[model samples]
Target: MTMTDSAPVAVTEAAAGPEPAGAARWVTTNDCRIVGRAFMAVSLVLGVGAAAVGVLTRVERLDPSAPDQILGGLNSWFQMWTLYRAAFVLLVVLPLFLGLAMAVVPGKLGADNLAFPRAAQASFWAWLIGSLIVVVSVFAGGGWGAMDGVTAAERDAMTLTLLGAGLVIVALLSGAVNLATTVISLRPAGMSLLQVPLFAWSMLVSAVVWLFTLPVAAANIVVVYADLRGRDPVAFGLPESPGIWGQLDWLVEQPAVYALAVPVLGIAGEIVPDRLGIRLDRRGAAASIIGLFGLLAVGGWSQDYFTAPADHRDELLYVGVGVAAVVVVLAFCGALADAARRGSVRLQEMPSSALAGSALAVVLLAGATFFGALRVIKPFELLERSTTTGVFNAVVAAALIGTAAGVWHWWPEILSRPPSESRGRLAVLLLLAGGVLLAASDVIAGFLGAGDRPFVGDYDSGAVGGLNAVAVAGSVLLVLGLIAAAAAVFETMRPDRPDGPGAGDAAAAGLLRGAGS
Candidate 1:
């Protein structure tokens, strides 16, 4: 029999029945589920590792002399943040989402396997290794790419960043092609274009989006490498030039908070209907999200980058991207509301539902803050844009939690068995609380005349010091949330993990009862 009609059965076959003949010896295996889970595990670790660094940076701010003692002075602090950004932007989120694509899309599409399995494997390895190199290269480059007086090691750092990024692009391109092909060609007998899950559709669209955005980033990386090596300074432009803005505008995906927002919103679409026992009133929701993201990628009308405060406060004026992002979501919520009105809907802090809500809140708050900026503060009167550090922190934290949520949502299918419950609900709660506190404090401090990178300053006997203290508390909570998340993920990957379906059928059955209700 053809594979398309049997794709769903194929997924459970590895565990639900006796293995295929010589299944262990099958060398050309193109298992989408395994690759996806592998990608998810690796990306989650990278995310937690970066967050741990962020906690260190925040802790350093609590004590005035800590940077010098703990982080090796200001130059290294610069490198630390740079590495964190590189890891956060280039290393974790996209791959984590794509990993979900790898695992979930085929099953959703009723495909036997990805269209190009070898290529998908290549894509994963390239991204995994390249991201590792890209992050390490930030340290190797010694903060000199954006600084002066480059040394031999620093030059190597620049070269590695370019090489690693190039490889990542290669991986992305391969996966994009493979995924698009799977969705188009591999549907079961009766499935059509619109029948695919919104989650899978979003990933397919994001793959095409990658085709547009990442190559430009790769070119920028090459230009940067050439400049660091003294190849053509005038050709590449220097650190403080407008060209750097373009480079950052690309890397600024987190601070901008829209590119990955599409798939995440789609994730919410998938979760809500299942958990709430309602059919999604999904009219125009998927298409609108895709269109909004495209506009967002173009910097959203008059906006330059949404994530950073210091980068372009001088020239950026429009709230086009923010408004569109917000509207698409509000439209989505409106649809969800309609569904709830007609069908059963309940308030849920289930891991998936909570993640979707928290992520949407983070992005909405950011868009609102910028919209509020236009009304409250003039551009010239603005404090250092770096004071907007909280926006970046909250967005990163939310996205990380969303990635964790995807893992939880798909864990059963990806592993071909039932899953164990860990502290997922707690993890989601801690992250949401942390994000709100972080954003409020950072934005308030920025408005109150705090400069970027000011780890210590007096309160002037007012709320500034209090807000700073509150931000520190938020950072601590963020650390706790991440630790909780890491524990949940690691519990799944343990070779001796006790989460086997045989042991957990009762729990799984209970979960089914809950979702069905």
Candidate 2:
């Protein structure tokens, strides 16, 4: 019998099974969908907290003269700065994408589930616990760096932070392995890697990049943790300064930062073609462009934590990669545009949150790469300026936009219902606006001579203060946007129907039935 003939029974039986109760349900479940939803939900909550912290940090920047008033002290201010970056990347955007991938990629690959379902569950819980520890440690006077001298208690907190960060990284890596294995090993008969859907291909590429890059970060955390626990702190775990941030900030900066946006390209690739109801023009070229973009984003060699900045950042290779990234993004955008040009240009039918979000994500990524390329020019002197923060903001915005698009597009599999189109569009607009403002203001402030350091907000330009104020406004918008998006997402999550039939059920069952056909 065809898989469809059997789906009702399969879904009914699946739904009728006794459900696990309380903590056991969440902790022991091997369902990728549940695990994925958990990742996305937690990331949204953390995103809001990070945005609020961002607002507070920028508010302090409004009056560089009174830096400590808002956050209470320079140490606290620095803590918020590093904490914001760490939390946003680790606890928010990366997990957001990874979670969605966990839910979506296996089905895309025609697999019944992830190759390592239990590992996916373990990864999520470990990531969640580690994320909490990271946040609590930061608020408890332990963060990536301490501007002032640290007390014994604070030192111990820093150690905890390292451990949490390590766990988070390892969890992410494990999740990546799950995704990569599913993609590589589970495609149906006659479907080569090239024949996979764009989203799946993009995920496979992203998984490889993460495997190559995040381990370096995990290694950095390990080294820092060991040094912090040693008799004497070394160059990395220096007592009372920005040393910790210096060693780890590379994750959120150029080349490496683009790693987070790899899936943005994939999301756009999937959305545009699907929304247009037409095949993408030059599909092979599109796939090649995505792969090239991923290649450029591999940033393991770009970290200069232990070496002089010039030794790595000033090298031809660094500059070439920085500049090449912009071209690669533009190429993918061109491919997308070509597809749209060939397809029927229906305006009313278009403009769904998914399409808008995808378009905005590509634009934001392009802007980010442009800024990154500009920073490589020694004359711009923007490498150590707030322009770095601009690049950071834009890249993150792209990821956020992409994920929003994915959420809307995959709502049936993800949230088990169609998203409110109006609400999704509103969230996309708010997020895009906030992201643009934050990135542009930072870039302009850097040109106006604002340093990269958050505490050094006293740039001579009064305009810099004005820009900081604008960033504060942007942060507020980000918080509101996140709330709107979260409400739209979580409100539809049926608490009582934990095992409702999902969009994936039929596809999963079909794959099982036709495995050897």
Candidate 3:
């Protein structure tokens, strides 16, 4: 057929928009940004909440006898459970959501919308419900026993089991949903796996890590729950074996932290080069990714040795090797940074939030590396018996501070607008002041050997006073950030009329006029 004959005649319909579909309106393929923004909002809240709670726990440790009822009653078990719960939410749940969002949102990704919107929605609801169940059960007061006093051995057993199982379910659902979406829907046409952005690569690796590690963590939680409930956990068959579960928990948690760190590292890799107006060293970036995954796999083996028997020198040696691997990973990070510092890589125009967040994450990773060295290289005798000391408190503080700062630095990008500067500045000041006061309390209390004292009536007056002040200061920071974040959201949604023709408007109009000619 001739070309003209092959071209079908077209009919033009009236240029009317579709009728409103009410609340049941289906999101089109072009709505990836909206889905991504929503996911990020929820993830940020969970992450920040976890960090704030962790910092408070650290402050409490600075002064064990502190009168300020931060989470109520200075009970060790209560504090332990709360901190563990918070850590799980932050490390596991938040990262899972972040991976899913990053997989779907960016323009480089082929996704027009979330790969499986229903699955994404289901994952969110499942995670929320599972988290709530775990939290509420803690306050139920029967299965877990009392907060002020020790629970009956029976109650302790039941409580741990319930919490662990709930967390496992949440982790499994999140990992599966994320992995499916990333593999099936995120890859764009003509883009090879090698060509994917560093962040997306990290997410891909993280999902695989989750697939392997989360099941192990879940198994460990189940066994621990059973042990707590006064049952013989080994009765569970095959995959649920208690001994294997313990080994896997250690394995999973070690790499899991790296999984969280890698994405932030990738974000740094991308942002720094762009901000400095130079091209990133693609080979260096790829090397960093490979080295990170290798280190994560090896570093994970060390957690098992933490509570292993003193005679297990072989286990200790294994841990040392893992530590060495981590050192290598740190070196890779240094290389990446050095490349940026040189003219080899430059960051083009990038958001301030990206710059801040990426910088803070790198700092946090550095701090983690320092502590890992201490824990690994120190004499086993000194490390094993040095529980509940000021030094230990310092390590915890470093981790908490690093994570919190990183989270805050990225808050604006995640929220899609600047948070109220007044509130952000106030939070920064309060965090600094609170950190100082808490550190001071630790010093004073240490001088009095408060660390050796029992949790009862032995009170370090100076420490108690200092901790109370720190708690108050930290609370202010938390409240202010929340208020500012809320205000930013409200302001963004408010309608406003357009001003006179600006650069963006003029450019658009010019394009339209040219098209007419």
Candidate 4:
């Protein structure tokens, strides 16, 4: 547990020069900015694909009577359905934030680069390769849940998918560790943890949460993979059941689902005050709320699949955690509001998309927590219903909004250019509309008795079908928003731009100068 020094670092501002060009530059560069951009670029592209998959999955549910008509088979539909959920969180939202942290956290802390630069690079490549494996294997008859059954080749593909998942988790964990170490061991002189930028502080907390929780998920995959390969099939290895998805579904559920969104608080904290040209009020309390949020989001203990059908959501501790999250979010929002109130501002100035997006992210999160509280209420009986999907839609949409906000707020440090406010606004509005439509429809559908698992022949109501259509529309809007955001990011890297490939170094150098000032 010692920090070993390895690889070259641009420790001085003078080192902010142009980097190598072409394939070798991206493939072999040790710069944290380039490494981070690679992660963001790949993740955003995959996010669009994942969101598209989600749209298709929802469309499949439009006619639940036929179930497999759109996808051709129960197993195929199951693969796409589970793939949409898994990829959206794992391959898209989490990695997008990790990339942003990698690019921005070091500069915020006055550090020259990530504590372990080569490891960051390795983590990016490993994650990318593993993501490809997961996507390919799923299409090749391997996915988290098998609805009907599987052939021998498909079984082998399932093992590959598991391996890819484990690799992806480990890669994300490695990146998180790098960020945590950079924050802890590389702070500038006279700066305490309390004085660190809110976003950096949030990343530290998120890193700890990821370390505590993600390994358990990795362990889940390991056990399931072992059972699948064993001579005798037990509970997890049965190829005909959806047990594997059940065991892993907790990651996308309540307390665990919130883990991927911890950075949303950080992004909001950093952006709101910065936009208002004022320091945050109750900074310490703000940090504490963030920490508490992250703490509640550590859901390694919330898995209930191994036990006999006893739902963990019914537990008092789980219900309390879900309900308390709303208060934490409200407290942070109040702090931001106080800061904004103390600022000398004009209404004509209006809010920037970054500011609006940050605020919207918090709102979406609060709405999600409200739904979570309702779902845990025994009388509501919303457990294992589409309410779970509502929570996920809201949470992931919040994360995406936060991602756009961060990019707009820190375009200089991340994208090496000024962000286009109009494009940013368009993206945020689309995401907001999409999030509301998707989440609200799902919640309403759940209240109408829509089962969590689709295509089991229970959903024949016209109201549910209309809600499903709305969700699909929301998914379409989400995809468009993501595309717009991605385009805005890539525009900064135009071939004619001076800061295209090696621009991140210069950006980092500028951030260091600003921090020193």
Give the poorly placed runs of model 1, Cα more than 4 Å off: 1-29, 63-67, 141-150, 188-195, 230-246, 253-256, 300-318, 346-384, 416-422, 452-465, 494-517
Find the 10 residues in a row with the least total lDDT in model 4.
493-502
* lDDT of the structure predicted as candidate 4: 0.87
Ranking by lDDT: 4, 2, 1, 3
Stretches of candidate 4 exceeding 4 Å from the true structure: 1-19, 495-517
Evaluated at residue 345, the lDDT of candidate 3 is 35
Cα deviation in Å at residue 457, candidate 1? 14
How do all models score by TM-score?
0.79, 0.92, 0.65, 0.93
Give Cα-based local distance difference scores for all models.
0.60, 0.86, 0.44, 0.87
Q: lDDT for model 2, on a 0 to 1 scale? A: 0.86
Candidate 3 segments exceeding 4 Å error:
1-35, 55-59, 65-81, 88-106, 142-185, 225-256, 284-287, 290-318, 342-351, 380-517
Tell me model 1's lDDT, rounded to 2 decimals.
0.60
lDDT accuracy of residue 180 in candidate 3: 42
RMSD to the true structure for each prediction, in A, is 5.7, 4.7, 7.9, 4.9
Whose lDDT is greatest here? 4
What's the number of clashes in each of the models?
4, 0, 14, 0
The better-scoring model by TM-score among 2 and 3 is: 2
For residues 1-517, what per-residue lDDT tens digits would candidate 1 score against the true structure?
A: 6466566667777665553344241333457766776677777778778767766666665554456666766555656656666666666777777777888788777776898888887788788888777777766654324432445556566667667777876787777788888887887778665667877766766676666666666666676667755754664534432333345443443224345555665566676566556677654565566555544544322224333454443444333443345555566666655655675544553434343543454354444335334322455243333344655565566566666666666665454333344476677777777767776776776667665556434323256667767877887787787778767766654433265533454357446636633
Reference-based lDDT, residue 187, model 2:
86
